[model samples]
Target: MALPDPNTSWPPKPWDEAYKVYAESETWRVGDADAIHEFYRGERPAATHRRDGELYEGGVVGWVSSKFWGRPVPPGQNRTRLHVPAPADVASLASASVFSNPPELRFTDKQSKNTIDRLELIGNSDQAHSTFNTMGELKSVFGASVLVSEWDTEIADHVWLSAYGADVALPEFRKGKLVAVTLWTEYRDGNEYYRHLERHAVGAIEHALYLGTADKIGQRIPLQDRDETAYLATLVNENSVILTGIDRLTASYNMNLPTWAWRKKGALANAGRSDFAQLYPLFDALDEAYSSWMRDLKLGAAKAVVPQAFLETLGRGRGASFDIDRELFVGLNTPGNPDGDKIEQVQFEIRTEEHEATTTELWRMIYRTAGLGTRSVDKDTGRQLTATGELLQDDDKEATRGKKILYDKRAIAEQLAVALELDGKLFAGKGGGQFAPPEVRFPDSAQVDPEKQARTIQYLSAAGAISVWQSVKMFNPDWDDTAVGAEVNRILAEKRAAAAMVPDPATFDGGDPTQDPNNPDNQGGNPDGGQ
Candidate 1:
């Protein structure tokens, strides 16, 4: 390692140059720690603190500019760490999470250069989560931590039904009960929990939209009883889509997602994997039927969901019109004493054509209801805001971009199978590049083992499939949802419903009706005179 060059302008003239040099060497760190500055700055959460400035808003893809909440290392002191100051107050988040008009944002300006990449934030529980693994390269962000527990209802945050017959609707049918699911996060003093009800439907689907908005993204984990393989096969067997590439479709297999109407055939019944598999298809169908314009607003005023606002206002056009009630747009908690533009007077109205589906508006409700946006406030000034509603998009994109991952294991087997048929040529055991690539449309179970299929292309690149496909795969990891997981949940939701149906099998004794066949059966099967 070269010794520090004292004569070379001490610590390099421009701070960036010095930072760059330090970054390449072991000496760099975010904070003054000499050994790990690079990791500090590099691994550090994107510092979200920003000043009161014009924010980037209202365009298909526009730039956001704001002030920098930075902790520049002292010259000789040697600290380059980047961090979001801790949040002490709850209202602080609502206050700090600001969307201002961009004030002469210039790339050259450090503060302006810190424009947010993209936005998405969900749930109050994340604040309770102790880890800062939201970092893109880290797995812990969405990864799970399992806890062993006794089968007690009082302990679980959410409830999951294991039986209810894999094909049955939740509680609507006497036999087909719901498979309950629970998600719990232990906090310092208590825990935060979310429970989900599963529903399903059966269909031969050719194409399905990926779960687009953020609210539904991370909730795809399956229930214990449903086989992941069966769920995926059903999705592809019924609905198949073959893509040529580039935001364009080459072919759709069986049929397309039911557009603009109730699917009398019920596309989601028995569709996904597991006891709770049906949930996604129902939501997707709902998103579609309502033209993504469900009456329930996905976003609320407090959420300050930018994309919802942006899409509702304009999917990037100056004159796009919509027909949602303007009343729904009122009463977002306004910021008090805002240091910047004081959008305390925030007001907006959208114009939509007579015929365009309320698709964009649909997402807004999903965004708001799912808690897609909100942020933490600056500790010192309390005026600085953190961009939350938007899940840092670019980073999520970069984190796993074509990040070679498993679709299922047998993809390699298929390649080898094809190879053997051609007289035993060796497979390089690699795929997913500009030339030879893995087929992304979840292959059918008969085509290949769904488990192995899930493992195959999944091995090459997780994010590389047509970028559009990510949404589809992101929510429907098992490839599709089930009607049971979709509808049953909505049916037998109340816990008490379980008691109304299943009698205690332990006490179900002493009844042999089969032998008597109604004592009138005495005439047919009597011991005295058999007819």
Candidate 2:
């Protein structure tokens, strides 16, 4: 579909629902306490239960606050509604697991590869590689991310790509391939929202500026009204379309993982699934467990209950506090009491063991549900393992990383292909040609034991379980067939050269120098023995 009609309702039903899902993931990913509490409360406005003439906020949101209190906590109370940000942590872990070492991009044609290399140098500061890392995190969070390649003569001669989260992306896919997309940026100015929507198609990109409110799309306004898009008015034609000299869509849709579990059914049923999906409840529980522990710590602090004489007064209207360091106290006795009032210490026992077990269990569930194995965290110490740390690459984490890599490889290939085409067309004198999708290769997970792997490969090669070339390929996963073959031939040639260095016994007069007849010492040895 072309640009939506000016007055039409914004974000059609599918997109609206998709955005809601994105919003939920985003709230957890951001881990904003207010946003989390507000989103959950708004999500279930009627999620309130009445008990003993009091209404309490229900569900995990309220549970975070009232779990320890055993009642609804007032706004100003000492309730600790701590948010763990497990969603953010999980997404980041997923991204780091896949992108700690960015993928190496190689083109089939030498010129195409060189052109891309030059474009990357001049386009932005390692634009494609760095953007891939960013997109990985976003794909993990939003389940999908969009990559759009474009060129601006005013900015630079090379083509650049932009990555956007699913929240701002309105993608149109055909047969599992993205053919068109409309990416927009919105900012609130005072009470109204200003939006700039850029639609990318095969040959043309349309730009539209809208003056909207908080919930309404308002109307389409002239591009001149918005400074960000004002330049488009001069570059675009009457319909605000810029003719990009490319055959394929410049935008590529990258999914984190494919599944039929997208909230919106029908055509989009197989869309990408977020890494945080099905893990929100676990996230909430994790936060609740942590907050409850913190509350216990606060409530369990030791207190001294002293008599009224030990109190210190600030002012007439101010409250008083019992200070044990007062150092001065007057002796007093009640009329009917023989002993004076005494100070007593009071303390509550903190359930440290219970809280630790609960939070640890919750973290394990989060790691497993997020497709990261329990090894993602050190259960004993409760420390999250970094990507570069000693993470045991279990079957589940490896499979999930593999799936994410698969999606990343396809998206990167398509985006780079389109980028190359545009680079050639937009810059006529620059390098250009018919290029197929480049061979994309990703490296192994960061924490893999390379020495162990090398030893295994060596043992296999020695046992004839695998060929030399196969061993080389296994050692270098990012290498293409040609590169692997070249390395294998080099190894074999070195082996042959080493074999030629050994002496041939058939050509030698004597195998041992001490027994050679030509040696004077050997000839004299017989004479000395005879004497």
Candidate 3:
């Protein structure tokens, strides 16, 4: 559905509805809504839960806590058990998925080469690659990343790309195209109501809503001080209104700032399901298992069985004097016996191997569900596996990740085309003609043996199967067709220059100055000089 007009309705219906939809979407995208918030604040869920008395309760007062409180154990002996791997792993995977290599933009039409170069220059000047990489990573975590492009006179380059997370921006689409976006920024200003500055394509609107109130329909809350720019006022006259506040009105100016959305998984019904959602169960299971394993290991090592006679000898009140220490020895008493026998210490073995196996399997599952494959964890040491192994291992993963990258690239390209078209009309005074869509080139994700690849290219070039320019391109994938052609011309020019400098054997003269020009050395030998 199209965006609701904010003028006639005062407040747009879609704005309120979209807010709820985005909130719920974000909740599902981040897995546990509360935990993900905590993560954003740099708090580990496992640590927070433990601190809040969720993981464990009470002090080290009972028999189990008393004996095992300070003793060394296999599992909880270190602080590793309290660590949560899901968030870090997810972030790492997300980073690796996008930032491993940079993307290339190619223009099919030679006439659009200047435009392509200008776009690339703008991207570099504004650090668009880094910004987009960060946005892609955010999409992996939050399920969606929205970006808006605008012309900024302040920047050296006139164009700029700004990235926003899914939390702040809400997009409305019509006929499979992004028509409008509503962005609301909330801040505190020493009032009961939180001030909000809502921006749309046409203009900016200012309003305030009550804090801590559910922003639902018919809340009876007063709208404090509504203000809008002249641009938005103009939109009310030009667009259609369905009585739902500012319906189908353009928010932005003639700029047509395109809103690009990059989703972790394409076209999901629940747009909020993040890349890490499916693996959350595995993370939870691993966390709980590690906690239990540590507890068991600690208790098992400190567990000791004592005879009642030994306790009686220490006396009822003096039993507290007995300290459990590695170097300390305790004497046990036998009835009617003068000699004291050594107490039999209870031996309990922690099933550390079993816990390790379970955790290994959980890690494998987490990696697999995250599309990282089971080889993500090393089989022998249970540590994270490196990505340098056989190409087959990462083939499927690269394919999946490549598809996402390509999808996002295409969406961004569409927005870029709009931006370019608008720039041509407004700045260049051209008739806003649409240029050919640029082709996006992503780096090969699969690992290739460079030596073997070079040999194959060499053989192909030598056998006349592929042109020298094609071989050069195969070896240097980063070079565009223009660059390849330039290099080829340069080589040909150098060869022509070298050929011009050399004397042709057919026109060569004899070393003897006296010899007749163009005559063979033997033909002129009969005269004064011998051949």
**Candidates 1 and 2: which is better by lDDT?**
2
lDDT of each model, Cα atoms only? 0.25, 0.77, 0.52
Please tell me which predicted candidate would have the highest lDDT against the true structure: 2
For model 2, how does the per-residue alpha-carbon lDDT over 314-433 read when each residue is reduced to its tens digit?
879998887667667774777786445677789998999999889888888888888887763674666655644533536678889998888888888887777877777777767665
Please list the residue runs of candidate 1 whose C-alpha ends up more than 4 Å from where it truly belongs after superposition. 1-358, 364-391, 394-404, 408-410, 417-422, 425-531
Residue 27 in model 2: shift from native, Å?
1.2
TM-score of model 1 (CA atoms): 0.15
Runs of candidate 3 exceeding 4 Å displacement: 1-83, 110-117, 150-157, 188-273, 300-347, 378-395, 419-436, 446-531
lDDT by residue (271-385, candidate 3, tens digit) is: 3435665555566577667867877777687555544444434566665433454354555556786544455566568889899889888876777666665554664664644
Candidate 1: minimum summed lDDT over ten consecutive residues — where?
115-124
Instruction: List candidate 2 stretches off by more than 4 Å.
Output: 46-72, 110-116, 119-125, 312-319, 334-340, 379-393, 450-531
CA shift at 150, candidate 3, in angstroms?
Answer: 4.2
Better of 1 and 3 by lDDT: 3
In the range 423-511, model 1's lDDT, one tens digit per residue, is 11111222111212123221221112244335544643465653324433543455454643554355446546877688788998868
